[model samples]
Target: MLPISALSGAPIVGRATVASIRLRLPLPEQLPPAVRDHIEAHAGSQNRQYLYVPSPVIADQDASAPLCAFVSIDYASDAETELVEVSRGKMLKSFLKQNFSRDADGDQILAALFHMVEHLPCYLLRYSDVVAAAQALETAFANGDAPSLMMPVLPAVENVELGWGDSEPDQPLVRRAQATVVDLEGEAFGVSADQRNIVHLDKGALRVLGLFDVRTREREVVDILSAAFPTVDAAQIENDVSGAVRRFRRAGLLVAT
Candidate 1:
């Protein structure tokens, strides 16, 4: 005997089976719209609530985005809800950071992704599928493969009291955040300090980030990069440098103090 109305997390694996007894009944507005509709139309019986696990499965037109966030949350538990929120925060931060790194489509892409998340349609999943998915997610989280955005546990915060260091009296201090993240040679993915966004570091971006150093200024960064590639136009170099800084700032990797 299983309690009906249990929604398995967004089924990334495939279609799943969910048990529910359909009936004809009038629903009320007091309940969430999704809940009401399911009962009124499908009539899956109403006393118990359903779980809508917010997943990080980004579906492309005919492709699959990375399973960036946790598999799902119980929603009924406070701690699980908190965990889901942290995962979502990391998802957003990662999204914004990746888009910001590209051309001007960053804001638009994020808005669309969030909209998709909010309006995600719930589906019924099979019991076996649910168990399997849950097991997989549990393993990922346990093995530190899933993106929880949690930092080093035993170690304390960096030496910088505010996470950002200070410069001379008049310099616009732009240094890397105290956190030392990986450069990820292939394709890198990370979240912001607060886990509200994601950061993707490609080779080109890594080239720019490689400029970070103590007491480094924006102009110095530009000069260093320009010196490396003496063929490109000076104006283009400035634009490229500015764009990279803006992206880094948004990603919380480099803060303008």
Candidate 2:
């Protein structure tokens, strides 16, 4: 099984672990060096210093309203995962479309939890060769980019071993085929015998996907919205709220107890 950290696009030449932060408020100058360093790394990669807050509240601030200082780096990548150049065409389009459509609705938490739970099963498959699988998914993402429904997914595999002697029958082979179990974040997920490669879609990974969806939703609302000077688009607000619900669900980070 491949390490979950490896799939996060954080294992750049010098990084240690992928970092993810959820921003509720802007970052202050008093932030610790570790936090500051991570933000700097992210900004530097994109050749930008800081990201602006594009929310309605910030955009619609009046002259008399109190001013805010800075935008927060809510999410960061893991250190062990390195970001590669990926063309976001098909999956991105589907993801965007589903996000913007009026009928796009679900119990976000349940959906997320289901997805996460499903991950355990998906990884157990014996994936095909890495290059072929990666290319296929990448192509799928590129081809599906028109309306943004399915979002792009690039899955990576590592630490693979065969459960049975499927290589050759020359030698006396006697072994029971067991489902491949990949250790992801200390938890094991089952992969199928046909899926030789492992694709990890963990909390941080899904969060990034959700962010893209949220961004699209915001774009749709802002484009069609015409309201008062201080108005926030209803769609945008709903999307944000629902997104929170989804994230909470995805992480299984909710509390019903």
Candidate 3:
């Protein structure tokens, strides 16, 4: 059965099918002052506890600002209680690389990573790969490679190729256009190298890498796509081209102007 709690993070696809139980509970306004005091006396003494404040009084004069909700996590002594606490909040650290570092907001980082994985053909790292990378990181830490569990893997995306190599020179006789992902960030959120590491789209990405010779301006991308598929419509070409740009740009290959 699906877990039930006060709040949810990410998106839940469906509702729980368990039998609903009604309780004879007092309404917030109807509760007596002594009962309220009794409830407050025992608050925050147990594991997996959550307090939802319906309305809060603000002492500051800036009352024009919208009311903001707060989430609190209390330490739990039991395993089940700890798991429940973790599940209540969104697991932002797992999905967002920026969460691993300072300077980025947790929500923004999660949103960016979500957009990349959803739209792009990014793959999640397998158990084996994650383990191997973990070991490598541990060894590095021991040998002074920076004491941290930082496993950076640049995985491939489907139908997208990433690599480094020579480009076909511009010539009138050959008309060969070599395409490489130079600068990828065109939109607010894009498929970046970090996202690539999380999602493994390697083989297909490698194949595309083999085809592309060099990375250039966004406009130049059209030239490469045209050269690769001469008969492809402009619209069709545009879609893949934009994705490529975003991926490469996120990888630091494409520099911002």
lDDT of 2: 0.30
Total backbone clashes of candidate 2, pairs 3 or more residues apart or in separate chains? 54
C-alpha TM-score for every candidate:
0.36, 0.15, 0.25
Deviation (Å) of 48 in candidate 2: 34
TM-score of 2: 0.15
Please, what are the lDDT tens digits per residue for candidate 1 over residues 1-257? 11111111222221123334332223222355664554445433243454332222433333322223323323221122122233333343444444432332442333344433323322222222323445545554564432222111222223333323322223444545543443222345443443333356666566766666465676776787789889988789877767766666655566556
Off by over 4 Å in 2: 1-230
- Kindly give the number of clashing pairs for every candidate: 10, 54, 14
Whole-model lDDT per candidate: 0.42, 0.30, 0.34
Comparing 2 and 3 on TM-score, the stronger one: 3
How much is 25 displaced in model 2, in angstroms? 46
Q: What does candidate 2's lDDT look like per residue over 28-141, in tens digits?
A: 544567656766565422213435222212222111211111111112322221223222222222232333323223322222222333332121112223334445445534
The 10-residue segment with the lowest total lDDT in model 1: 1-10
Query: Candidate 2: minimum summed lDDT over ten consecutive residues — where?
Result: 65-74
Quote the lDDT for 249 in model 2: 27
